[model samples]
Target: MIIVTTRQMQQMDKNTIESFGIPGRVLMENAGRGAIEMLSEHFDLEGARVAVVAGRGNNGGDGFVIGRYLMEMGVSVSFFLLSTRDRVQGDAGANMDLILDLLAEHALSQFIEIPDKDALEAVTEILLDHDLFVDAIFGTGLNADVRGIYRDVIELINDSDKAVFSVDIPSGINADTGAVCGVAIRADATATFAFAKAGHILYPGNFHTGDLEVVDIGIPGHIAKAQSPHIFLPEPHDIAGLIPARAFNAHKGSFGHLLVLAGSPGKTGAAALCANAAMRSGAGLVTLGVPEKLMPVMEPMVVEPMTTALAQTSSGGLDAAALDDIITLLADKAALALGPGMGTDSGTQELIKSILAIASVPMVIDADGLNCIAKNPDILATVKAPVILTPHPGEMARLTGKTTADIQQNRMETARNFAEKQKVILVLKGAQTLVAYPDGAVFICPTGNPGMACGGMGDVLTGMIAAFLAQDLSPESAALAGVYLHGLCGDLLAEDHAFGFSASDMVAGIPQALTTLLS
Candidate 1:
């Protein structure tokens, strides 16, 4: 789905009304009707009682229209106006006029305009008693924080102990940053128009917009395509098309070869997991390279994985002598999964720097591998290889010389900056994993949970990306596809003993997730 910012949506609306010749008022009526239809699809509104909290904007016009429809359909819907009917302007003013005449002719409940301070206080309990609260007090245009009476009223509705259904967007949340503006109404569901707002899919905003329903508000698809928004919420079908199917006559050699430079001594589990995950991720073959001293131990850990012994320091880390052999091996490899169990000893760092200085295949760098590059962040510039750096917040902080808090505060910016400067894709792994392209586009994953915080998670991701690269997917496609599948596996396992499960459990679910795509 196309995820747009407030500016993009407004521009689209303006162009639709002006360029496409769709009347603005016509679009408003369609948006309101579309939202009602969406709500009706999931809910039985035959007798449902609703409260529409309206402001003096187009969003308020949407609320008023929904109220009129609900009332016409034998449902009880009361409109609580933040201001008097005379203050409503433009399309909103026009819509309120129609509603006022309808209420007067039918002797229906007139919209309770907060005439004064006493009236405002009295409406608090009245709003709290409804089955649903419709938030149309604000839309994406709100740039400043809401305060005074508006803030207090928003808080009152939120504390109502009733379910909420926001129109266009929930009031007081910044559409671009997803930051709460003074106060915000936590909607149980939101019906936004045409394009899905970036805030709906982003962290705190997504959290506030429960079960978002993107209503078709008459915006043309070509105009949206023309806008060329950089952000997107990747769906399964989108990535499913990108997953290349094997040719009918395909053999093991046609699948792809993956190289894994991992393992010390005690951390052989990381190497084993990386190699095994590559095989599961559809790699034709996987070669597990370990410190020469740990080869005997690593060999026993693998059954089908090919093994290589790299020269090691006394600490069982890869020595500089290992580079020539690694280059020779990389000649036949399609991609490389680096860092997993690779130690951070000087000799290992030297070996890593050597491989990165020249390795041409796609690379997924993680763990100790990332720390090696942290010593010289600029080394990322010289490496011509297609690189994907999967870093947890601490590792990201190390690479950027910023605090973890700083990175998290503006994750999109931090990841995009690092990736652009380094000329590599960055997968900033956390609660909502952000995969940032060097070109400044960032994708926020809505999947994955706290359970994925365990060890070997990053290792699994490295292997997955390597396997995708081996199959000829571009660096951006590989990272996006890899993280989506990784989180999906976690989401599936979450259904049964998933949260209690470990990183290996997420790895185990990888094949299951592929079946959904492969089929």
Candidate 2:
């Protein structure tokens, strides 16, 4: 599904009204009707007590239209206008006028004109008694912090213990960035127009926008296509297309070999997980190159992938001297998975630097490998091989010299800037994993849940990406497919269990997730 910014959506709306000749009022009516359709499906509108908290904007017009439809359905709706009737203009004014006439002719139970904070406070108790609320006080265009009477009313509605259905988006959310503008309504569900906004999927704002339903309000397909939304939420079929077809007669050698350089004195689990995950991801021959002393530790832990000992430092971590051994191993390897469980010793960092300087195969650097390069990111520009760096927010901060908060606040831009500058595929791992390419294309993975926030997950991901690369998928395709399949596994597992599923559990789910793609 296309995830659009506020500007892109607004422009699409403009083009729909101006170029496509769809009247603005017709769109408003369609939006309100579609929202009502979704609302009716989930809620019983007949004889139910509901309040429509309306502003003077187009979003408010939607609320006004909804109020009329609810009244027609025998739903007792209280229209709480944030501004006087005369203050509402454009399409909203037209709808408000119709609602006012209908309310008087039918002698409706309520119409509270809350023009100021004092007016809103007077009706707080009355609003609390309503069974449901329709929040149309603000929409996606709101960029500044919500204040005055609107803020107090929002607080009152939240405290009411009643379910709220938001129009377009929750009030006080920045549609483009997904940042909450001071405070926002925690809606039980949101009925959006045409396409899903970025705020509906991005965090903090996503918390406020519950159960999003994108309503088709007659925005032309051509207009939306012309806008060319860059962000997307990939579906199963989309990911399935990225997976390369395996020939029936293909042999192990035909699949490709993956080399995993990981493990330390006491961190054999990370190395074992990385190499084993590669085997699961269809890499023909997976090998682990660990510190010579740690060979026995990983050799017994992982049975499928062959293990080779590398020159080690005194602490039993692979050192720069291991580069010669790694080169020898890489001769048969189609791809490399580096950095997991590799301790951050100076010698280990040197080994990472040496590998990057001359490594010919596609490589995925994760965990401590990312840390080593964060110390001297200039080495990224010097690497000749195709590179993929998977980092959580903290590692990303260290790499780009920005605070973790800054990276989180602007994930797409931060990842994009680094990928473009370093000429590497960047996978920003977190709640919503983003795969960014040097060409400015960014794919957001909507799969995965809080259950995925565990250790060894990144290591598994490192191996998965390397496996895809080994199978001859492009770096961008491999990174995107890896992140999607990884998250899909967690999402599937989440259906049966709330937590306690380990990275190993995720590894086990890989084949099932791949099957889901074909299904």
Candidate 3:
């Protein structure tokens, strides 16, 4: 599904109003009604005491509409206005007046105007008595930290422990970055109009926004299409459609051969995991190339893939001198899976440079391979083949020469900028892994869980990407499908239990994950 930023959503709303000739008031009405429909789906309203905590904005106007609907339904709704009634303007003022006119003599008990912090405290106890809350203090336009009466109101609503259904977005959450501004409302659910915002899917904000329901508020399809949203969350069919169909009469060579250069003395397990995962990911054949001395160790560890001993340094990692032999070996390989478990020895690092210069097919570079290239990222420009770099935050920091905190704070931008500059596909691996393309488009993977945080997970992912590439999927398709499948495997394991699944266990779940997609 398309995920828009705050500005993009605003533009979409504006286009709908101006270009499509849809009145802003009609849009507001649609929002209010849509929210009611969403609320009705999740909650029962008969005789319920609902509180509409509203500010003097469009969001507040939406609250007034919801309150009016509830009142008509015989559900008692109290409107606690954060601003003076006169301060509300535009479409919101129209909605507020309608509520006032409809309430008539009942306004004395149903409408309480808490115009400032002093009045806000006076009615805290009364507001807490409601069975449910509708948060409308702020919306997507809010860019700064929330303060004063609004903060107090949000905190009180959260402290009440009542189920909250927010209008547009949760109050005090940054609708663009998903960052919490000061204290924010922890809603049981949110009813956002038009499209899902970045804040709803991104962290902390995602945590604050419990169950999200995106309500269509009469925004024309052309308006949203005109905005050209570049960010998206991949669905099951997305991966399933990209997966190449297997022929009934095909042999092993019909898939493709994958040459994986990995492992060192102590990290042979990493190499074994990568190659084994590649085989599991449907690669026709996998050749594990390791340091000469570690051949005996990895050979028995991985059964399906054939193994080869490459020239090694004294430290037992592949040496730069192995370049000639590697070039010869690559002659028949469909793709190169480089980087997992190859140690950070000087010889191995130099060997990485040589391999990058000579690789002709797509390469999935990870782990020690990424670390070596962070030392000389300029090598990325020299690589002739399409390169996919899988980097966690620390590796990304090293490559960008920025702090890890900066990378995490701006994951989408950092990944997008780097991929565009280097002309490579970047898989920024994390909770919500980002697959950034050279053209500035980004795909976010929502699968996987915290249980997949253990070692060897990236190695498994590296192999999966290579396997997809071997099947002739483009770099983007391969990365998206591989990352999604990798996460799905972990999510499946997480369903049975949490936190103890190993990388090998994840590999075992690959076929099941693929089945889910195909189905």
Candidate 4:
């Protein structure tokens, strides 16, 4: 599903209103009606008292529409306008007038104007008496910190312990970054119009967004397509479609061979996990290449993957002398998984540079492999094949010469800018793993959990991506599928246990994850 930024969504709304000729009021009505439907589905509206806390904006206009509908349905409704009746202008003011007319005719509902803090305090007890709170104060345009009576109103609603439903987005949540603006309403659910915004899926905003329901507010498909949203949330069907069907008559050679260069004296487990995960992810064959000193250790640890011993440095890492042998080993390989446990010794770094200079297949670089390149990132420019860099925040920070905080603060931009500039597929692994392409398109993986935070998890991911590459999936498909599957595995384990599931456990769960995804 395409995820839009606030600006893109705004442009889409503008295009629909001005170009497609859908009036703003009609859209607002549709949004309000859809939100009411969602609320009815989630909560018991019969004999319910709903407080429609509204601002003097289009979002507030949506609240007015909802309140009018609620009154028509025989539900007790109250409108608490943050601004005075005259100050409510535009479509919002018009809708407020309609609500006023309905109330004047029937005297069924109450309309309270609390434009200042004193009025807000005067009605504080009345506000908490409602069965539900409809948050329509702010929408996707919120950027700065929320303060004044607006803050106090949000706090009251949050403390009310009543079922709160947000409109478009939760009030006081930054619709673009998902950052909390001072304080935000933790809604029981949020009804977003047209499409899910970036804030709805990203970080803290997602936490506050609750059970999100995307309401079709009459935005034309052509208008949405014209926006050309580059960010996406990968659904199960999308990832399932990427997996190639296996041939009935195929043998080991049909799937493709994966060559993994990993392992050091103490990090042999990393290589084992990578090679094992490759086999689990459907690689035809896997060859675990390690320093000569670790051969005996790796040979006994792994059963399916064949192991090759390369020349070793004094520190027991792959040596620069192993370059010729490593290149020869890549002759029949389908893809390369590099830098999992490989240390950053001088010889190993040289070996990494040498391999990149001459390798002729797709490569999934991670861990120390990424670290080696961070020392001389320009080596990525010299590569001839499709390369996927799997970097955690720290590694990404090192590669870009920025702090880890900087990378985390703006993960989307950081990933997109780096991928576009470097001309490589970049997987920024974290909470919502991002798969960024050289063309600037980014896909967010919503799978995985905190339990997968343990060591060797990324190594498993490296193997998964390399296996997909070996299966003839494009660099983009491999990265997207791999990240999604990796997270799904963790999620599957999380269903049974919250945390403490190891990377080995994740590897064991790969087939089950694939089954769950494809089935």
Estimate the TM-score of every prediction.
0.91, 0.93, 0.96, 0.97
Which 10-residue span in candidate 2 carries the lowest summed lDDT?
A: 103-112
For candidate 4, the TM-score is: 0.97
Clashing pairs counted in every model = 0, 0, 0, 1
Model 4: residue 166 alpha-carbon error in angstroms: 0.6
**lDDT of each model, Cα atoms only?**
0.84, 0.88, 0.90, 0.92
Q: Of 1 and 3, which scores higher on TM-score?
A: 3
lDDT of 2 by residue, 1-519 (tens): 888888888898888888879899999999999999989987876678899999999999999988889888878889999989889999999999898788765555578899997887787778788898999999889989999989888888888778899999999888877888888899999999998988888888889999999999998777788875277888888888998788999999988999999989778899988988888888998988988888666778898999888899888888999888788899888999999989888999889898999899999999889999999888887899999999999999999999999999889778887888889999999988988888766788888899988899998999898999999899989999999988888889999998889999988888988887778
Q: Candidate 1, which segments miss by more than 4 Å at Cα?
A: 84-87, 115-118, 143-146
Report the number of the highest-lDDT candidate.
Answer: 4
Give, for candidate 1, the lowest lDDT window spanning 10 residues.
Answer: 101-110
Predictions: Cα RMSD each: 2.5, 2.3, 1.6, 1.4
Clashing pairs in 1: none
lDDT string for model 1 (1-519, tens) is 777878788889999989989988898899889888877775667556788889888989988888887777767778888888888999888888888878864443557897456778887777666777788899988878897777878888888767788898889888876778888989988899987776777678888988788888778888887775267778778878878988999888887899999988688989988888888888899999899888778888777789988888888887888888999999999999999988889888888888888999989999889999898877787798889999999999998899999987767768877877778899999977989898877888767877676888888888898889887898899899898888888888878864678767766779998997656
Considering every candidate listed, which one attains the maximal TM-score? 4
Model 3 whole-model lDDT (C-alpha atoms): 0.90
